[model samples]
Target: MPVDQPHSSAPDILHGWGARQRGGRIRVKGGGQVSQIYAIRQAIAKGIVAFYQKYVDEQSKNEIKDILLTYDRTLLVADPRRCEPKKFGGPGARARFQKSYR
Candidate 1:
C-alpha cells in the first residue's frame, strides 16, 4: 500500500492494515504532507456513507468494498518524470504559457 513516499506513507498504511477489525473503518488522521490526499478522500467517503445511511441504501457496503479495493491497490504506477505536465504537451512543467507581448 505504499504510495509516493515510503517513509511518509508508512504510518497511514499501518493504520489501515488493522482497521478491518473495527468494522472496516480506516482512520487515517495526521498532519503530514503525504497523508493529506488520503485524509481528504476518507472524509469525502464518510460523507457519502452518511448520505447512504439516510436513504437506507443496501448497496453502500459494496461501494465501500470498491473504495477499499481501490485504496489498497497502487492506482498510480507511472514514472515520476512521465507525470510532468509538459510531457503531455499542454504547456510547460507547471502547465503555464509565456505571456505574449504582441
Candidate 2:
C-alpha cells in the first residue's frame, strides 16, 4: 500500500522497484513501530513467495526468496531476542538499587 494511505502503518517497502506489482492491504498488531515494520516486511515476503509458488515457476520462487534474503535476511527470519523482565530488587532488568554507606 502507498505510504500516504490512512491504514498504512508500515514503512514504504512495498513501493520499491523489486517489490511485487500486485496490490494488497495488510494489518499488523501487537508491537512497536520497528516490530510492526518487521512483521509487515516478513508478511509481504512470505506472501510474495506464496504467490510465486502458486502461479509462477519454482525457479522464480527461489529467485524471489534469494532476493528477499539478500535485501534483508530478517525479512524472512524473526529475531529471537526479547526484553528481560524487570526483577524485584531493581527498577528495570539488569539494574540494581544503589547502596551507599557513609
Candidate 3:
C-alpha cells in the first residue's frame, strides 16, 4: 500500500508516514527490472515475505525484459504470510533494485 511495503497481516494498509518500515508487510511485485529469485528467497527467509511465486514462463520473462528494455532489470515478489504472524515472522534479504547509469 505504501509504495512497496509488504502487505500487512491486517490486509488493510497501515496508515502512517509514507516511510514506515512496515516489516510485517510484503510486496509481491517489487517492480524493477529483471526478477531476482535469490533475493526473494532471502526476503522470505527473513520473514520479510511469507512466500513467493516466480513467473518462470520464458515468454513472460522475455516479455518482462522487453518491457524493461528502457531500464536494466525487474523484480517480482510475493508474500504467503500476510494475515498471520505466528504462521510467519523472521529475517529475509530485503528486495533490491539495480540499474546501470544512464
Candidate 4:
C-alpha cells in the first residue's frame, strides 16, 4: 500500500534547507555528529518500506524489486511518526501561547 499522504518531516526538511538553516546534529553511538538531513532520508526509507512491503515480491529478481532493498539499510534515523514528541519535562511538541496584556 503506497502511503496515504506525504510524510510531515519531508516538508520540514525542505523548508529548513530553503531557509539556509542547517538541521540539528545527531551524536553517533561511537561518538560523532551528523546533520539531521540524514535523519530525513532514513525516515523516508522507513516510510517506503512500511507502505510498499505488500507490493514487493521477495522472490522476484527484477530491478524494481531490488530497489526496495535499499530501505532495509536505514540505521541512522527513526521515523518521526513512530516517535513520541520529546517532552523535556513540559508540553510535548506544542508551544504555550503567550498571555497578552492589553
Top-lDDT structure, candidate number: 2
What digit string (tens of lDDT, one per residue) describes model 2 on residues 40-72? 767877887787789888987797778777867
Screening candidate 4 with a backbone cut-off below 3 angstroms (N, C-alpha, C), the clashing residue pairs are none
Model 4 off-target regions past 4 Å?
1-33, 54-72, 75-102
Clash number for model 3?
A: 18
Tell how far residue 7 is off in model 3, in angstroms. Answer: 20
- Candidate 1, 1-102: lDDT as tens digits: 456454334224324423232234545666565556545454545444454557656576446446544664322221234344354433666665556799
Ordered from best to worst lDDT, the candidate numbers read: 2, 1, 4, 3
| TM-score head-to-head 1 vs 4, winner | 1
By summed lDDT, the worst window of 10 consecutive residues in model 1 runs over 73-82
State the TM-score for model 2. Answer: 0.60
lDDT of 4 by residue, 1-102 (tens): 124134323423323222234355433343122324445555544444443445555442233224534423333244355545655544565655456799
lDDT of 4 at 8: 25
The per-residue C-alpha lDDT of model 1 at residue 35 equals 55
Global lDDT for candidate 2? 0.71
Q: Please, what are the lDDT tens digits per residue for candidate 3 over residues 21-42?
A: 5456445565442233334533
- Higher lDDT: candidate 1 or 4? 1
Looking at candidate 1, what is the lDDT of residue 101?
A: 90
